[model samples]
Target chain A: MARRSILGLFSDPDTTANAMDALRGAGYKDWELDILSGAPYPEGTFGEHMPSHHLFKFPLIGAACGLAVAILLTAGTQLAYPVVTGGKPILAIPAMAIICYEGTMLGAILFTVFGIIFESRLPRPRVGIYDKRITEGYIGIVVTSDETRVVQAEKTLKMAGAIEIKSGA
Target chain B: MHNGHNGEALAASPEEVTQDILRKHREFTPRFKALVAVLAVLFLLGVVGFIIRLQDGFEHRVKWGYYAAVVVYLLTTAQAAPMVAIAPRLAKANWRRPVSRAAEMFGVVGLFNLLLFIPLLFLLPSTEGRRTIWFDGPSMSPHIWDTLAMVFLVLCGLAMLWAGSLPDMAAARDHSSGRRQGLFAKLAMGWRGTDLQWFLIRHRIGALASLYFMFLVFTHFLIASDFVLGLVPGWKDSIFPAFQALSALQSSIATMLVTMFVLRKWCGYERYIGLEQFWALSKLLLATSLLWFYFWWSGFIIFWYGRQPVEQNVISLIISGPYLPIFFTTFILNFIIPLVLLIWNAVRRSILGPTVVGCSILVGTFFDRIRLYVSAFSIEDVTAHALTVVPPAHTPDIADILIIIGALSGAGLSYALATKVFPVVNIWEIKEYMLLRVQAAFHRMEVTILAKPE
Candidate 1:
């Protein structure tokens, strides 16, 4: 058994739930931990209320910028070289509304996608873990505990349902 | 004393009963039969109108109506399909139990769009000597081959939809009974619920959906090429594909809404397509309608302000000309009317209000298509009173009408026939619903259990 156990990383709801239960049952709520998964797993599923994700909200902000840009683009074009087309109103609101709406949606989508990538910490500099089972179908459960409890926690999880148990050196 | 369901008084859970109804038996209520008859009739009428359209030669543009027909094509086929097709893909939920069939219906009806192209065939010299009072008209364009290819592609698109719908037809067929159905026996191709057949069918369904998305996009872009892409001034924007995509989505969802609403009361889908589902469909229509207005406006402003004199002529013609009423009606039907009706949550939640809005959108979108085509192709130089400016597009020539009518009749007839061969919805998927529900319930219990302190 390793001298210290720290379940700092991994993300699989099925396994995460098991490990969290194991830690809490063992009375170790203070252990540093994180999760990695292919998709967002509504952190509450792990028996903990996850920090709120504001990535989707960024679309709303992008929408605001979109509105400004649309107004500027439509009005500025007319202002820069006012098209006096048979003397009609140059700053057309009906037409401008379209511009604002489209631009805002576009901006919001771009930010939403980017926000997900940013929040995900995807495309890491190096491999976080080396296990083929994680990709195949196995949920990796990394448990990080203090020196005394590291071995105890590892034994408990491997007995519970860890296909392959590992620990920090 | 019989306190419980003893003779058949088993205390089976709700899931068991829901499963029994979904799996072993499903009856098409009188409401659905009536709806089916109504749909069939409406479809047949469209066919008849199409047949009537053929005789009057498409050799030359009618006084002002040719442009009107062309614009209708743009809105119906060009604008409506792309936006809604991607919705099920976007939501990525199994809850598509309610919407998938309607979405597929859009893909299927799109195939009939080629019938409208028959008018262009009237210009060919080959058809010149081929004059029957009702069936003969020279082709409308110089290239008969291109026209033929488009017509062919539209047919192929329809075939793909037919093949995909086989399983659903089989399900619907088996689910019906008595003289209550005549169409199913003829249409159903012995769907005896074999495991081997079900697996083969699923593989085919997946393949066709991918093909529909890929080919339909190409088919629609060709529309831009066939109509708008070639037109100058208004045609300059490269965003036309995006516009067409959004428009198709709007129309498809709007059409789906109308179908669902009609089906519920008329087909007894009150149990099937519920209020929650209808609301979902409306929300989709509303979103895309908003998207369309945005695209329409952006395209408008670009030319309205860019004003290189040539473009100004097109703009002035649309805004104030003899064409203003058509444009405004298009706006109201496509935008304002549906928008006002659907904006109130209470109204959209109502049974008929959403349906009316949906139908209005469908009709408006039709006018919108007419507006796009006629505005781009025909411009009235004279500024006359509202009534004096332009008349509705004249009916199609006899030959054009025949081919178009025959094609649509073929679709309705085929859809009726196709119903007998497959179930209307995914039968296997319906079975899976209970399992998912049970698992969900278990997962909830597990959470509660774990939450309790020792």
Candidate 2:
């Protein structure tokens, strides 16, 4: 069975919410439908399922790696040269603090950026049943189902007052 | 929802706001072009000045002091401008929506600042036999670390700018055609405003904003320590770098206020940016102005009370000696004026008052940099334990003046060019702001009820 996507555009948020409810009532799971809008409405605005994410883990991992690297570099350089300065011992923790701080921050920033792109599913190869009008303040409810169920999904969308319906394989 | 004075509503429907902002964004008027042309010419002159000054070479460090001052001035002012958006957004302030992009757009100037910084690196003397934080490190310790910090800061800034503008790029991609459409499509990276994408964008922005703030403070610490304090003997003040960072915060807010005023007064963005934004920012400006005095006093009081011979020399060189007039000017402009003016409700709550204070602080910061950097650079020997004699003030030559004008103009030009690529007012933020607020009657008064999303 080939899956197809159906996008129903609505001018009003209420109608969009109704369309989501209609889809839910018609045996389509929350994972099968997604809402797109111009503005970032709060999560669950259209009664959509909120997906869990692991963005917080990236920074912690990065910081640990960075701290480890910084400690090694600082301690390694001090031990290699083994020069006493201001009567301070080699492998001075105080001396290495600044570099360590900067390293941790730098690593966290880089990893967080990578995490955003990965988690966002960015550089998506295909837009998939997207309507340009969605960026012009229209609300789009997109449903992904088998070809046999496309007609039923389109019927539910029309009954909920969708102004336009776009379908794609 | 109506602003009352201009007969313009503060809130508009999403579609109306999108079309209106995008329409203004696409327009390339004669005035805007002329402004860019003038800045370009001035920038070219600054380049010529730079080349002419390069002929003198790095041996004469004094000649390059004013140039260093200009770079630090740009660093404190324009490069720090992104905080105006970052700080408020972190606080979840709704008033920041309209002016957020304007603040972030200043990050584009960081590239020009980095270019200007390369020459200063060569001009800086090696740290051998000098008092520095890097006690027993490699020969290129400070230089390598300084360059990395700057590169990291610039990267963080640009990344934050790009991440914040993703949704707007999507809007541009959908609405545009031809080369612009292609360019925006690439920049958009196929953004579709999915729920997951939005959640990721918000988290990314938060993370980047936090990172940018940390990097900004760290960079200021490095520059203040290595570029100025490290060069000037017997000027060991831990508070100095924090003071510079504080001033950067103050100056960045001032920069945003001035930019907001210009956009409202000239760019026909009065509807989006208004008194509410100005009024909200003015309070922060007031708080920073007070802190400016506290930080200056906190640093100055140590030397003033101690009166050690070396401390006295440091004081005379920067404060009581040849640069006394410049010091007074800086004091009045950066502290006295803002404190007096912003203390008043009438001045602090209005658009023009903050703009006026912002201009004052900008000029004050310029002289402040000159007072610090030029004086530090004029010292005869970096290896000396204490200043033996206070060197006379090194006045700006024509080349110095050109560099200052050119560097500032270059920053302005970069920001102007960025506007043509991205909308100055963030479309989605403004729509979200309007979405979360509604006017309701409270007894005899109409007040706005704001909702915070979890």
Candidate 3:
């Protein structure tokens, strides 16, 4: 059984939501369906599955790593050089604080960017089964299933008011 | 009693918005080409001036004072312009939708600023025996650290710009043809407008914006402390860096306003950018203008009241001495002028009034930088406990004048080129703005209902 991708484009948000419902009602799994739109539609606008992400942890880990590195660098340099200025302590915590703060921020920012790229699954080698109309205010319900199931999915989409349906393997 | 003139409503369909915005790429008018040509010529002249100045090298810090002023001017204005976009977005302001891309487009100037900054690194003396944030950290402390901070700030700015423009890039990729389509496609990174992608991009933009703010403040602090305060002994004003950052905030709003006005007036984008944006930003501009005076006063009053020998010299060197004229101009242009003009509700609500104030602030900021950097750089002895003698105001030489013109032109050129690459107004954000709001009849009046999504 060959699996193919079917895209049902709708101009109206209500129609898109109805198509999503019809696809699910016609035995399509949530995993096999994806919704695309020009603007960021609020989650569950189409009654679609909301995926959870762990984006928060990336910055925490990065900040911790940066702080550890900064502490070591500041403390290690002080210990190695052991310069006494006006009988201040070897590790001048106050002086090190600025660099430490900057380092932590830099790490957090870099990792947050990385986390976005990773979490978003970006740099996608190809935009599979996409419609140019989706970038022009159209909502697309993309269904990837076996050929036999795709026909039923197309019927469901049309019956639920999809303006156009596109098929690709 | 509502103002009926909010320009035209965004009544265009999403596809129409995309086509209208992208149309600028195809229809590069003679005026635009002439503008680009003029900027390119000026930038080339700036390069020539740079070459002429390079002949002097880092041996004479005074000679490079104007150059330093230009660099900091760009830093505080162009580089800081993105904050207009960032701050409003963080607050979820509705009026920022059309002009957000205009603000973010200034990030492209950061690359040029970075290049101009490289020469100053050599011009800046070592932190040895000087009171600096670095203290006794390392031999190359300020140099290495400042460079790192600058690089990080520039990268963050570019990343924020790219992240904010990602969806627009996808629109460009879809609507464009030939080489442009290829470029936009690569830039878009196969963006398919999936739910997950949109979610991640939003988060990324927020995080980058937050970080850019922090980095901007830190960079201002470092530059102020190292380049200016550290050079003049017995001038330890903690509020100086904050003053610098605050003035930057004020100037950045002005920069955004000026750019927006240009887009609306000249670029035929009046339908998208309107009195609403100008009016909203005018209030902020007025607030920052008042705060600008407050910060300057907060720093100045200390020196004025204390009247110590060191504080007196510092004042004389910076304020009442040879730079007195420049100081007065800076004060009036940056504070008094904006205050007097923008204080009125009529003026604040009008497009021309804010744009004029913006121009005034820009000129004021330029003179302000000249007053600060040139005066600091004129100091012959960095190791002196206090300024024994005040150096006369260093006027711009031929090269300095050329560099100033060139630097300003370069920033403009970068922005104009970027407009061609990315849509001048954001496509998706504008569409989102439309989707989230509706005009409803309320009694005999109409009201706009805006949706706020968490």
> How many clashes in each structure?
67, 0, 0
Against the true two-chain complex, what DockQ does each candidate achieve? 0.02, 0.78, 0.73
lDDT of 3 by residue, B1-454 (tens): 2342333546667778788888865578999999999999999999989989999888999999999999999999999999999999999887888888888888889988999999999988877777788878885778987888888888888888888888989988988889988999999988999887777777778888888998899999989988999888889899999999998999999999999989888898887888889999999999999999899999999999999999999999899999999999999999999999998999999999999999999999999999999999999889887777888888888999999999999989999998888787887788887777778899998888878777
Listed per model, the TM-scores of chain A against the true chain A are 0.67, 0.92, 0.90
**For candidate 1, what is the DockQ?**
0.02
Task: Give per-model CA RMSD.
Answer: 15.6, 1.5, 1.7
Interface RMSD of each: 18.8, 1.1, 1.2
Chain A TM-score, structure 2: 0.92
Q: Write the per-residue lDDT of candidate 1 for residues B150-242, one digit (tens) a residue.
A: 543444344434544443443444345675334443443443222223333343334334434543454455454444333323335655656
Docking class of 1: incorrect
For residues A43-121, write the lDDT of model 1, one tens digit per residue.
3456643344444455567667766786787678667766654355767665455345445544544444454335434
By DockQ rank, best first, the candidates go: 2, 3, 1
